[model samples]
Target: MPRSQAATIRESLSAQIDSGLLPLGSKLPSERELSELFSTTRITIKDALLALEAEGRIYREDRRGWFVSPPRLIYNPQYRSHFHDMVTRQQRQVETRVLSASTVLATPALSQELSLGPLAQLLQIRRTRSIDGRVVMYVEHHLKPEFFPGILQQDLSQSLTLIYQQRYDIRYGRSRFDIFPSAARGEVAQALTLAEGSPILLVFRINYDQHGRIIDCDHEYWRHDAIRITVDSHVAAGE
Candidate 1:
């Protein structure tokens, strides 16, 4: 199938960025100039810009025109069932900075969420997630070390789901997610390279096991402009 004119324009611009022809934060040509250069209508150029914006590659300024945006944070909670999996699935370049990992006594809130015993020790892992070399989100996860023996030795930059599936034969059952607008805290701000109290999206997720045991709990804070979440629902035939 033939690609649309807008798609072609988007591809051309994307190639420039990828090849370092269009450096980060550089302003793109004006809509009229792009239209003339591509031999397309200005409307087509606008559509291309919108597509790039959706992908987090560019943004519009009031009077300064369009400019390359910082890298976008990709979150695909739908498949492979882990942050690293979702990121790699999009073929996006990324880096994970492990902020802290240690065995700690579960707090009251953590114990209740994970259904842990009062004195249970949880393996807490915290990381800063980056996309295309830009910090984008802060993540904190808790797991039962007893269930994931030798987990500390594994490379976490890869999918956690892969590790459990390959090493322990553990598969994710169902998950519950809650999202809300929030203000970034001190450490979260530093990790995400944003100012303290910056607007962000806070996500809380609970992953359960086949036997209904809660296996993991995660808290993620994402930059407001770098992430998006989509949900879809369908009615049953009987309904």
Candidate 2:
């Protein structure tokens, strides 16, 4: 399939960032300005920005406008299974500001996604993910607390995947993912330093284990300009 217009805009902006045409902390052109430059509508520009935000490439500041974000460590979902694992493997300085972490009754959506029965308790972890001191992504994860005893006691700044590996010996297996462009929610805007309705990428991931048991469900909001996901497929020799 051909890439969408938003995807094209995303690539153009990303190229600028990669080539240092737009340096970290440099303010991006205003929506009106970008629309004029791209010869498209402001709405298109908005969509493009949201895509960049979800990739953790650019951040918006209240009244100050959008600025280029620091580079994010590339994370290959096909190979890496954990956020902290991928970041640490890249040797990038990473930190998580725990926005909220507590046990909560699972909502219907959470229950359905985690494949839990009604009334199941869920451990909710909300974090603002930062790299090199810049906020780039906001994540909310739902996990069954019963499966991960004493999880709340561990240092959340470390890799949650590693924690599982050491504590429970559970490893991530195959997963399904869906990605799309979205506008920032109110809290997401605040966390990513973006305006309400700023552009971002929404990633919904469902992870499983060796036995095909659901492990966790993750909702990741990335700065649109900061990352790109590449998928390659080929048929087997026999096929």
Candidate 3:
């Protein structure tokens, strides 16, 4: 049995990355260049690149070519700390951009989920988050307007949790999370600089105050390779 060309190329690139020859965030060579260098077809180069991407060693930014990936951020949905604090603690740069805001009429399902009035309108905020200069997460937030007056006038690039606490004296007491694998599409794909149908991680979360009243909900879409989820449980298995 002979080693496939794609496998050889994949291993060669991986070794370079491991040795720091291809440093983190360094863009990989064009497919044509790789094919010429490897004495292989462009399709073979594509195969190897895709394999490396799946392994989290490399990632492609749409129209920008592929690049070595940064260290994956550890994510704990159950952790109460806000994202800005967490990133600062880890010594990594994180940036949040508030893309847009609008009000939308809540349907019966959304009204029930967030306990809004029958005719209530929810304020929707769209944001994108970047880690170490690479855009990695796109979030859509829905909030009740009555909870935070003048919220839109604040510097929205800051953490929402911090804003809620400082301005409204509200805190995130309880959270419900639903995590799942998803595919990047439409606005999320554009925000992430990823091609449509790229693998993604979606987190749907609802936050409530101490008294069980809904505060807000978020739809977070993360680059599949950008996060490593960790959950610490107090109870042992099969308790």
Candidate 4:
């Protein structure tokens, strides 16, 4: 009986969301409020909410209530575009919050990937990105410090692609990419406001400079439902 009630509640809320009654990024009624309104228990309300979450209709934050999910951002890996420009073209607000930036030594795996020595210094930058005011991606980038001088002094929140081009006269060239689903944990989970073991889509990028030398690598962790990866056959110029 409770499951049926939960289903009915989930359907009702989903319809509200689809009809724009709840609106994207808008918070839903508190569980207590929902329970009282539906004459049901909090557990029943939670079941409905979880169902809605699983369907990607809504999402919750730690201690924060649920909110309507925005439309999934369409991402085409074949298109060589900056994050800011891409989000702007989609007509959604985008924000990049720099969590930390510092110089660090490259790990063995990274050294092998970038063809650098074990002790090579790298510029490590960590950021959390938001779409429509909802945090969705946590990215960690490791750049060869020698490639761009004075980059650490520049604004880290802006598009690093632009920074690489305009500041250092560097343009992206051929790249290798990898994508897979990963379990959100630790810092990535905390940045995206997801539970420790929540599912996330992980994207790895190995970028090169116009001169054919490796420049940087990025580790992108996205909320599973926040983006849709669609890559057509059209080869991008730099790819």
| Top candidate, metric TM-score | 3
Error of 4 at 84 (Å): 1.1
**Candidate 1 residue runs with Cα over 4 Å from true position:** 1-76, 235-239
Candidate 1: tens digits of C-alpha lDDT, residues 22-51? 987688999999999999899999999878
Clashes of each: 0, 18, 0, 0
Q: In model 3, where do residues sit more than 4 Å from their true spots?
A: 1-3, 107-109, 117-119, 235-239
* Residue 194, candidate 1: alpha-carbon lDDT: 55
As a whole number from 0 to 100, the lDDT of residue 184 in candidate 2 is 84
* Deviation from native of the Cα of residue 213 in model 1, angstroms: 1.4
- Ranked candidates (TM-score, high to low): 3, 4, 2, 1
- Between candidates 3 and 4, which one is better according to TM-score? 3
| Most lDDT-accurate candidate | 3
Candidate 2 per-residue lDDT over residues 106-200, each given as its tens digit: 99988887878978998888988887777778998887776788888787766778888999888887788889999888899888887788787
> Model 4: how far is 37 from its true place, Å?
4.0
The list of candidate 2 runs beyond 4 A from truth reads 1-22, 28-59, 69-73, 88-91, 234-239
Against the reference, the lDDT scores of all candidates come to 0.78, 0.80, 0.90, 0.88
TM-score of 3: 0.91
lDDT of 3 at 156: 89
Candidate 3 lDDT score relative to the true structure:
0.90
Per-residue CA lDDT of candidate 4, range 130-208, in tens? 9888899999999998887788889999999999888899988778999998888988889998877877899999998
